[model samples]
Target: MTAWDQVLELLGSPLMQRALLAAVLVGAAAPVVGTFLVQRRMALLGDGIGHVALTGVALGWLVGSWAGLVPQDTLALPGAVVAAVVGSIVIELVRERGRTSGDLALALMFYGGIAGGVLLIKLAGGTNANLISYLFGSISTVSTADLWWTAALAVLVLGVGVGLRTALFAVSHDEEFARASGLPVRLLSMLVATIAALTVTIAMRVVGLLLVSALMIVPVAIAQLFARSFNRTMTLASVIGVVVSVAGLVLTYWQDIPPGATIVVLAIGVYAVAATLQPVLRRPPPPQDPHPDMVDDVLLVDDVDDADGATVRRPSPTT
Candidate 1:
């Protein structure tokens, strides 16, 4: 096939359609919440929650494979959501009780959960079929059910995200001040955690748990270098994500590289280029401070007048 035909053929494939849809939807939801996640210095929270999704995927596999309650392919999501919620609550509890930082607590939780998942996999005789998918995502393995789940999750996440935009803004900027201003900062934090967890779960199906967090964070990180407002950040991040997703899929199809890894590499490339170009594309400065101390002598001189009413002020000299 010619190169153009090959590209067109891949786009027409059912698996490609499903994979692109999942990537686009998850990409949209991820960076929207990620804007806040990055600002709050909780980028690792995405990693932690992505790890938490592994527990869900394992449990889902176990239940479907062993208990026959749900199909094997369907196991990953429920387990991910439950584990994510638990991880969020645990992070909060650890902060309140142990006085530990959220990062420390999340690190502990992620390692502990991974250890537990390994033990569980060993106990189940370590089937390579289900385990490999968690390590490296398979776009071909994504089912219609998984696509529907992702779409539903995307809608729910975006709804909460849009409705509580202000509360999230407040919490991201200043938790104490948000609470003082009568915003439900604690509740909003939970809401944000829940959304993050949900997005992590859905995105895992597209990118796998190991690299899914990168999809959530890297795109937004790149967009922030150029985006002037919160809205612009989300838009640019989504656009970058979509472009990378499509390009990654094409590269994966041609080179037989893992799609998830290709996606992350493309995202990193975008960030690297943006970072390099940021110096040349400086944003307009924020509004200047109103205080007189901040005003330059030249500017202050412009504000003053000489006895003759000229704008320029004469400097005093001493003999």
Candidate 2:
């Protein structure tokens, strides 16, 4: 079959449809929150949260096995969300109250999360394959329910992100200035952290616990190379994410490669291309006049004599 015929056949499968929809939603949502994270220089936080989320996935599998209340796969996402949120809150609290630096706190959490996840997965009787799936993503296993939940998450992330765009921008760019302007800097920080955790959780379905940060950061980095404004960066990053996700999925379908790794590789490739061309693509500044004073003189305009009987006005620059 031709490439188009293969793509058409893949699209006809309901399972493929669900996987593609999940990928699209995740692709669209991750980079929106990610741009803010990238601006704040908190990109590694996604990786930390992804590690914590593994513990949550293990816990969900354990609970489901013990209670027989639901399928293990069905419970994993919620478990990951809850764990990730709690982990974010803990990180924030540590950064606020603990004497240790934020980097130290994140490092401690990252290691602890990975260790805890491994122990929990063992206790849950999860096989290495199960662990690998969560670590590297198993797009073929994404269900219809996963698709719906991912869609809802995409809506939430986009809505909250757009609604608070100005505040997020202000806080991200200059926290002290934003606080001086009476913006609740602390609250907004917490909100961004929480949203980032959620974004990581949603992206895990497509990129897995180990590489979710790639989805959240690579596109934003690429966007920054080409975009001069924050809004444009966000838009371009999101578009790049969607394109990579779809392309990755198609490649996986045709080549039997791991979907998560394929997606990340594609994103990194784009970033490489953007980085290579950035200097060429970037516009040069307009040349300044050698005789600035003469140019200023040309801009100056004489003011009309004031109401005072004496003419006191002097030439002043028009601009």
Candidate 3:
């Protein structure tokens, strides 16, 4: 079959349909929450949360194996989500304590999370393939249940993002000012962090732990290059994200490449193009005033003191 035929065939299949839908939902939701992260300069926060989520996945597998409560794979989702959310909240709490810089706290969490996840995975006897799937994603293996769960979480992310857009922008721009203005700055920050954690977990299914942050941040970066305002950035980033996600999935299907990596590569390509054109596309500086001080004066002139000690007011530079 030709490439287009294969694409059509795959689109007709239930598995491919689920994968595409999941990608769209992730594309739409990730950049929305991600815009706030980018604005707040917390771009790596998602990656850190993703690292912590690996431990949750391993723990879920172990608990499910021992307790027989659910399928190990099924349990991993909630486990990862819970772990990520808790990890994010802890990060916030640490930031509030004022003992460490936010970057330092995130870096510590990043290393600790990966270390804990590796240990848990080894203890759980998870196969290398299972570990790889979590790290890099296996979109072909995304089950129907996974699709619904991802969709639900995506909706929640979008809902929370839209409902609190103003508050989020206020806190993101200036927390001290927001606080002084009676905006629950701490509470909003925590809420945004928690929502970001959830976004990372959901995005992990489509882009994997290693590249989830790329999906969350790259689109926003690209949008910022061309967008004029925060809302415009969010909207344009969402569009860019969906385009890249769909294009990546289609290309992966055609070339038999890794979906997560392909998606990230596509996003990077978009960023590269945007970055390249940013300077060329920027608006030129407005024309300068010839006599900036002349606005308050009835007559515009440059005074010159001659040898006679008398002031001669000549017309300004423009004249």
Candidate 4:
């Protein structure tokens, strides 16, 4: 059979289709959420959460072995999800409580989770190879179970994102003012924590916890190269993410490289090209007229609000 025929054969399989679908959704969703994290200067937050996700994977394995609730090496979705959420909350709370800087908190939580996970693995007597696969994902290992769980979490992330849009915007612009306005800042902060945790938990199975942050950051980072407005940035980020992931998966089949790493490397390449072209595309602002200032006599002031709640601005920015 020809190469095209082999590719078609793989695509025709239900399992392959499921894996592709999962990759597309995660590729889109991670960057969509990541834009917010990146804008808030919380980029390191994803890295921390991704590391903590390893603890969840380990705990899930331990739970499976101890309870005999699920077969060994089966999807441990629930255990991982729970552990990730708990760990994410712990990290955020540490920051909120003034116990440490966000970076320090993340490092502590991540290394602690890693240490704990290693101990658990040792206790379970699982082989090093098993841990290696969990640390770095194997595409062939992404089962139907993983796809379903990832799909469900993707939906949840989108839902929470939509519902929290206003609060997020407010908090992003001015946290102190948002709190003063009684916007439930603390609750919203926790919700953001939950969303970050959820993103990491679901992505771990596909990319492995070791590289989950790539899924979360790469697309958004690339999107930043092309978009100016926040909304446009997110939309473009999702599209870029989905396309890169699908392309990477296909390349993996051909080149025999790991799918997750391939996708990330492709994203970085795109970002680099965009970065190189950005300066050339951006035009310098037209020079201002050097004549007398036309608006020197204008004294701008905020007009009082009328009954209809419209502010009649006499002059602003024109002066």
Top of the candidates by lDDT: 3
- Model 2 gets an lDDT of 0.85
lDDT, each prediction: 0.77, 0.85, 0.86, 0.76
Query: Worst 10-residue stretch by lDDT in candidate 1?
Result: 310-319
lDDT digits (tens) for residues 17-84 of candidate 1: 89888888887888877877887778878788777667666766676667655456455678778988
Mind giving the per-residue lDDT tens digits that candidate 2 earns over 191-267? 88898888888888799989999998999999988788999999899889999999999888779799999999999
Give a tens-digit lDDT track for model 3, residues 57-135: 8888777776766455667888899999999998878777883588899998888887888787777666657777888
Q: What CA RMSD would candidate 3 show?
A: 2.8
Cα RMSD for candidates in order: 5.0, 6.3, 2.8, 8.4
Q: Candidate 2, residue 22: CA error in Å? A: 1.0
Measured by TM-score, the strongest candidate is 3
Please state the error at residue 63 of candidate 1 in Å: 2.6
Candidate 3 residue-wise lDDT at 100 = 51
Q: How many clashes would you count in candidate 3?
A: 0
RMSD of candidate 1 to the true fold? Answer: 5.0
Model 3: residue 222 alpha-carbon error in angstroms: 0.8
TM-scores of the models, in the order given: 0.85, 0.87, 0.91, 0.85
Candidate 2 vs 4: which has more TM-score: 2
